[model samples]
Target chain A: MSEILLQIDGREVEARKGMTILEAAQSAGIFIPTLCHHEKLEAYGACRICTVEVEARGRKNLVAACVYPVEQNLVVRTRSEKIDRIRKMILELLLAHAPDAFALQDLAKEYGADKDRFEKEASFCIHCGLCVRYCAEVKKKNAVGFVDRGTRREISFIPEIASKECWNCKECFPLCPTEALQAAFVLTKALFSP
Target chain B: MPRINSATELEELRKGILSKRDPNKPCIAICAGTGCLALGNDRVISAFEEEVKKQTLEAKVDIRATGCHGFCEKGPNIIIYPEEICYIEVTPEDVPEIVSQTVLGKEVIDRLIYTDPNTGEKAAHQSEIPFYKNQMRHLIGNNSKIDPKSIDEYLALGGYSALSKSLFEMSPEQVLEEIKKANLRGRGGGGFPAGLKWETARNAPGEEKYVIVNGHEGEPGAFMDRALFTGNPHSVLEGLIIGAYAIGSHQGFIYTRHDSPQLRNNIAVALTQAEEYGLLGENILGSGFNFNVEVHLDIGIFVSGESSALMRSIEGKNPEPRPKYIRTSVSGIWEKPSNLNNVETWANVPQIINRGSEWYTSIGTERSKGTKLISLSGNIVNTGVVEVPFGTTLREIVYDIGGGIPNGKKLKAVHFGGPMGGSIPESLLDTPLDFDELAKLGAPIGAGGMFVLDEDTNMVDVTRFFLNFLTNESCGKCVPCREGIRQMLKIVTNISEGKGREGDIELLEEISEVAGAASLCALGKTASDPLLSTLRYFRDEYEANIKEKKCRA
Candidate 1:
């Protein structure tokens, strides 16, 4: 693999071929806040919180540091006021969906996003893609997958029908970043109580 | 007759036995699934045996304990072959008359037969019964025909022929090609192509590749895998052996949960039996392929269901998930190339190989080809395992197969895909059981656990219960899952307890993003699915709890 030269957080650095921006930043001891990227599984740029401004081949754009492989002469910004604001907004949006989610709360605190201004949507879907990734990548069950387009897109067992292949194992619920998947025990009480 | 080893051989064996016996001889198949066993089906079996013995009609009568018949509401059940006479709710005391009248006289037992709640007509035959008639039972249909304990019975039905053919005739590459042709995907939760996984492990740069069978069914109210383990262990073993051969693996392990003692014992017995018959160890079936299998009991941790966690348990480490970038097929279970598949996924291999890929593909939707075995439980009439072709609608499953909500209760939301799966409201009940279909609805077909919720259920409380579960089960290695789930739980609990704040919902969405984006494993990433999906579809319920300080039904 050829060594790729890049500028991270305005500091010049060299990275190996195919190394992600996150990897490049981490090797340089530059911390980029992230939520969905795991070192063990394939990089899922679902959270989009790890976005970074990258200038490659004279073209500048924001991309997920976890999934974006480093190229030669790539200029990357790990931290900036704009990036911080976007990161904070992402956290705030996540909080709107899952207010009690401790992980997001901590990230909010770390990013200095203490209060959210947007009207809270009645939804638990943070759109993390764990359920989609697991179904397609891990279990290979393919009984469910991501369907439709972005924003309106969500995980389903089938395209137009509620899945019969779904064993109801609840594996996806735990993998869901938002509490879109509800457990039966909670639903039972929710149904009965006035 | 010589001992049979495969499903093909079993079919021949069945033919031979049928050739000699009187075609008119009554064949009684008792429901021997674990659920039925819990209701004292064993005693019922014994009573029928004694009655047959007392009547001196052993030669003319054949009684076998078959796998789950799928109708669990009215077990212990018995279905007489040829006539297809269906008997439900049979107790030990009802055995004498069953043997004397049904077995001896060939008369239907009206009292024990299932009466359709709507029609008021007694279902005398298994085929005529609405529970069995309304749904497709492609995978589990065999459960009604073969005895799980008797490999001979399975072989007599031609069970292991697929393995035999794969070993003796087909090359490893050929096996992979066949699987690819079938388009058989993993039946666990992840629906990646099974053949692709085998090919990856086979072609990966390694001298040793391992195959691990995941029997760690930790999902609440799910028991399909357990039923397969307990009832038909050999079928799964045969599939594993084929997988091992394809991947060039010498050793394999069945990582079973500790809770199921009967399943564990059944698998042990099957392994011992296979080994004795030269079907499991040291060059099985006189073929050059050498494969060995062992059942590794898990310590009953929910996290063990995760691939990394399952691998950790196999390696004598605490059941905790490792980082994700390293693919198990590349570096797993002692850092060797490993192919890990759930019990049901393995079981489908032999069927696909034997029946041919096109036949398998013809059953389900375009993307999701073949049938899926789902454990249908919670607020339903028929709480048992059903194998239906992919793309079957939730309405069909809950109504046709599950016999709808019990006691005429209105169906509110159907919780598919377990904890990690989202709940579908009644509006989306028409969604089919396919990979892409459910994904579009913001839910995935998890390990095939479907919990039907009645109109009386509360969505907010349901979200809290799952949050509580994920919080407790979090490996705690990542801050997002550990702290994030805890905070989500607190907020959801507050809403459920009528103490939610105006800004609480926004707070939850933020936390969900962090957990989804930052969590190291699937556990944390999807920990918020229940809450998120509920918020998307049932936001009114959350708002009612938060604003009105009450759960509105």
Candidate 2:
């Protein structure tokens, strides 16, 4: 495979073509914390935990390392105070919805995220897109997709109704890094209604 | 009578059987799908058989037990072949008239046909029904055409030809290459490239390798895998055989949930038939390769679906996921390289191999290739199993395929994935079902579950429902999943009950971050998806519960 050159943490590194910033950083022994990115599965940037500062073409911005592909001559910083603060803010927002979620708590602790920084709002989906990726990419079952645009966007099955195409295979539920997508069996059992 | 060994022989037998049929007699096929079985289809079938014998028309008429007909609401359903006549909501009491009129006189039983709720037009055949006609049945359509208990029915349909080809012609490497070309990914949930997983297992260093078919479907509203196993066990088995050949595994197991007795029995019979035909045991069909399969019943537990947890259950241990740092392909199932795939994933194998990979890849989007089977349930009209190509729009599925929402209620939200999946509002309906596209929208494809939401559903209450599930199902092996779920549940509960504090949302975010970052397994790591996605998209619903002390839509 052809290789591309990139600079990370002030060091030049050679990476395989089509490698993501996170993959490039990992190969160079630079750790970028991520939740929705799994080695066995494709990249899903929903969790936003892998955010990193990228200096490319004289522009600097925070990008999710898991989904953002690395280009030649790209300059990336895996860690910094700005990146850390943004991660902490994202974590704080996630905590408001699912404070009891252990995965969210661990990430918050690692980033020194405290409970007082943001307002608490309960939510199950961290918008990691694992379920969407699993359906669209892995299962090739387009039964579910994004229903809205921008901040209002989220995942859904067709026509807002469960279709016959859904095998209820439950493949997407576990892969979701947050509770956005869930298992009905678990949910019904929790309800104790039947 | 001699046993049928292959599709060719089975076809010959079928020809003989059809020739023997009297022109005046009709063929009655009673659906024996799980849904109908629960509704006492067995008794209806036996009653019809007795009525035929009583009328002394046994020589002319034939009675068969077929698989699911898909319309679960109207089962125990029956279909009379040749005329393609369908009978719905059948009972033992209706057997005599069916035998006398439909079977003997070759007349349609007026009361048994399906009447459309709107048009009031009775549908006499399965193909004419709107529920089935609007959707493509592909893999599952075969269920209604065959007798799951009879291996001959399967063999009559060119089954096992793929296995023979793999065993006699294709080397393990060659088989893996074909799969890679096909672009099939895991249907079990993660959608990892199927070919890549097999290649990894084939190349991984280990003296022994094991292949497992994950029949332990723990999803609440999902029954597609179970239906496939019960209605068409051969398809799944053939896929497994090919998968084992590619990975050089001599031993394989079908791990089914213990709750499914019919599926378990169906697989057992199929295994026996395969062994007898020299297709499953050592040196199958004169080929030098050796392969064998066994069925293992699983105690019902949600986490057991995890690869490591399933492996542990098969090894006679408690089912709990081991850390992911140790890949299962390298250190799974008695510390041997192992390959585990769900039932649907295995079922797609023979099709990909037979049709060629390029043909399969041509159906879906650029990145996601081929069709996916989704289990549709909750607040929908045409609820059952459906298969569609990747990148198909949600509007096409929900409105066109699903026949729109029932009772004309205004649409609210749609839940994709499952309890662990996220809920999407109605605004993003045009989004296509592609992997990267959905990821950009903050949701991933889950094991195909789509729960439709209506005005009656409370988002906050729904979030609480999932949190409670994660709280109980969490294995407590990791702090993030175990404790974080508890705290999240409490906060959501407080919000729902009008006791939520102002900073509760912020606290939830903090906990979600820690859990996502530090959890050892996928369970702990992604347990907060429901809360987080809801917060991102439907924060107003949560605010209404907390700040406004209301559960407004």
Residues forming the 10-long window of minimal summed lDDT in candidate 2 chain B:
B1-10
* Model 2 chain A: worst 10 consecutive residues (lDDT sum): A185-194
What tens digits encode model 2's per-residue C-alpha lDDT throughout B1-553? 3544544554466566556545545678888988898899999988988888888877777788877777776788888877878888899999998877877668988889988776798889877877667666767878877788877677667677787677666788888999998878888778788899998888889768999999988866777788777888999999999999899899998898888778888899899987877678776666666788878877766777888888988899667676543478877999888899999899988887777788888888988888777776677776767777888787777765666678887666777766567777778777777666665565666777777776677888888997887766665443456556767788899898888878888878877776666455667667788788889889988887778876676
- Model 2, stretches more than 4 Å misplaced? A1-194, B1-25
Q: What would the per-residue lDDT of candidate 1 be over residues B367-466, giving only the tens digit for each residue?
A: 9998888899889988888888898888999988788887788999988777778899999999999988887787788889989999899999888888
Q: Which candidate ranks first by lDDT, i.e. highest?
A: 1
B-chain TM-score of model 2: 0.93
Lowest lDDT block of 10, candidate 1 chain B: B1-10
B233: Cα error in model 1, Å = 1.3
State the fnat of model 1. Answer: 0.00
Model 1 spans > 4 angstroms off: A1-12, A15-110, A113-194, B1-24
lDDT at position A149, candidate 2: 28
